[model samples]
Target: MRVEQIYTGCLAQGAYYIVSNGEAAIIDPLREVKPYIELLEKDGVKLKYIFETHFHADFVSGHIDLSAETGAPIIYGPNAAPEFDCIVAEDNQVFELGAVKIKVLHTPGHTMESTTYLLIDENGKDHAIFSGDTLFLGDVGRPDLAQKAASMTQEQLAGHLYDSLMTKIMPLADDVIVYPAHGAGSACGKNMMKETVDTLGNQKKVNYALNQPNKEAFVAAVTDGLLPPPAYFGANVAMNKKGYRNVDEVINQGMTALSPEEFETAAESTGALILDTRSNGEFAKEFIPQSVNIGINGDFAPWVGAMIGDVNQPLLLITDKGMEEEVVIRLSRVGFDNVLGYLKGGIEAWKTAGKETDQVDRISAEEFKERLKVGESVVYDVRKESEYEAEHVEEAYSRPLASINDWIKDINPKEHFFVHCAGGYRSMIAASILQARGYRNFTEIEGGFKAIAETGVPKTDFVCQSKVMKA
Candidate 1:
């Protein structure tokens, strides 16, 4: 028997592949299905099942497409009513895959249909549990995401989550491996550890939610400090519940290459937003006027979902020449399938054609310090509130990048200021958005706070996050 955790770092998501005796099962796949198919073909195994932990909100799952291709049944836990055909397995029901068995444990609480799949090896010994969003290595899934769908308050869902963990999960043996769906960087759970896999015993000791003395404490702990879900989350969930365009069709449509003039004309005709997916430094140096930059090298997909907010927003791409398809695929992962095309020869072609370009004013941290020594300068720290609270440049205002759309109107265009994130990526993104909106009175610090911290700038000691949030 072989169990593999296919971890995608960008999403911090894990999909599982388990095979035993020429039969295999996939758990919570990504939007792209070709890789899984190739792996199956190479292994000479028939895909017997596609298991969905829940209708995911972060990225569209490939269950529908994978099932269509492999003729494997898409299995869900009880109370799931997806638009497509699938077998809704009851709690405790077990399915055979060649020499092994996978038992369904209807855990719920992350979502009504959330489940954990327990793998029993050919020797009839419990091997591992693919503990979807229901349980992370150091945290439990946030219960707020399913409030609207389940018609339960976050507290109520947290209660269910407590019961589910106490009963369905905690009873497992200490040696049983726990494979979670997401890790530290994911928005699915706030306190997830960096490690993707852990033994159940270690989780019981280290995970806060698992050690709660009672359901009340568990509910309060789990529901605390949840930021609002990203704007595109519900739409992604809808696309997953109903169906979505085949990834191949989306990719093929997005692969259309257009000359500079054609790209300009298409943008005008379709009113598509131009998304530049180059590195932060390159994008800051020069880009098409009014184009938004969310660099492909960073947390590209989730940032796109958070900043763009609308999946149906038509987008034209300005990517590094060979990265067009990758940008499209990442966009598709977050359910942004309306990609019009890409700039044929990238920004170089546009510039060669005498197109007007824009650039953000950037300064090294040392330069910023020299300027600060000369006089008072407005500075905006675009890091998370928690990071800002931990330690930030004294007098830097907390206007997190995620909440930029809400707080941007407060920025006085005439006032010159400095902007920075942890390592300049988000600050550049913020700078581009600011420029697109005609706000040009800001300089982005070259290396963000990481650089600023090294320049002997006056920084505040640890403070309460509430103060930062209020700012």
Candidate 2:
């Protein structure tokens, strides 16, 4: 028997492939299904089932497409009513895959249909549990995401999660391997461990949610600090539940290459947003006048989902020559399938064709410090609020990039300022958006706060001070 965790770093998501005796089962696949099909063909195994932990909100799962191609039944736990055909297995029901058995444990808290699949080896010994969002290595899934769908408050959902972990999960043996769906960088859970796989015993010892004394404590702890879910999350969930356009078709439509003239014409006619997916540095140097930059090298998909917010927004691409398909695929992962096409020869072609371009005024951190020494300068820190609260430049205002749309309106267009993220990736995204929206009186720090610190800039670290007073 072979069990492989196919981890995608960008999404911090894990899809599992398990095979035993020429039979295979896939768990929580990504939107792209070709690679999965190739793996099945190479292994000479028939795909017996596609298992979904829940209807995911972060990215569209490939269950529908994979099942359509391979004729494998898509398996879900009880209370799931997806638009497509699938086997809604009851709690404790087991399915045979050749020489091994996969038992369904209906652990529903992350979502009503959330489940963990227990793999029993040919020897009838429990091997591993593919604990979906129900349990992460250091944290359980956030309960807030399913509030609207389940008609339960986050506290109520957290109660269910506590029960799910206590009864369905904590009872497993210490040696049983735990494979979670997401890791640290995912928005699915707060405080997830970087490691994707861990032994159940280790989790029981270290995971906070698992060690809670009671359901009330568990609910309070889990729901304490959840930020609002990204705007595109609901749309992605809808697509996963109803069904979406075939990924192949989406790719084909997005891969259309257009000359600079044709690209301009299409953008004007369709009112598509121009998305430039180049390196941050390159994008900062020069790009089409109004194109928004969410560099492909960073947290591209999630950032796009957060910043753009509309899954059906028509987008035209400006990517490096060989990166067109990749940008399209990543966009599709977050359910942004209305890609019009790409700039045929990239920005170089646009420039060569005498099209106008724009550049952000970026200065090195040392230069920023020198300017600060000379006079007071407004600075905006684009890091998360937690990071900003921990430590930041003494007077830097926290304007987290994720909340740009909300706070941008308050930024006085005439007042000049400097913007920076931890290492400049997010600032570039902010710069692009600012420029696209016609606000240009700002400079972006070259290396962000990390560089600014090295230049001897005075910083403020948050300190909790309490004083005792006597009457």
What is the clash count for each candidate, in the order shown?
A: 0, 0
Candidate 2 C-alpha lDDT tens digits along 48-80? 999999999999999999999999999999889
User: Candidate 1: which pairs clash?
Assistant: none
Instruction: List lDDT for all candidates, in order.
Output: 0.93, 0.92
What shift in Å separates residue 241 of candidate 1 from its native position after superposition?
Answer: 0.5
After the best TM-score superposition of candidate 1, give how far the Cα of residue 36 lies from its true spot, in angstroms: 0.7
List TM-score per model, in order: 0.97, 0.97
| Candidate 2 lDDT for residue 285 | 88
Which stretches in model 2 have alpha-carbon errors above 4 Å? 373-375, 462-471
lDDT of model 2, residue 14:
99
Give a tens-digit lDDT track for model 1, residues 190-245: 87888999999999999888888889989888888788889999999999899999
lDDT over C-alpha atoms for residue 147 of model 2: 94
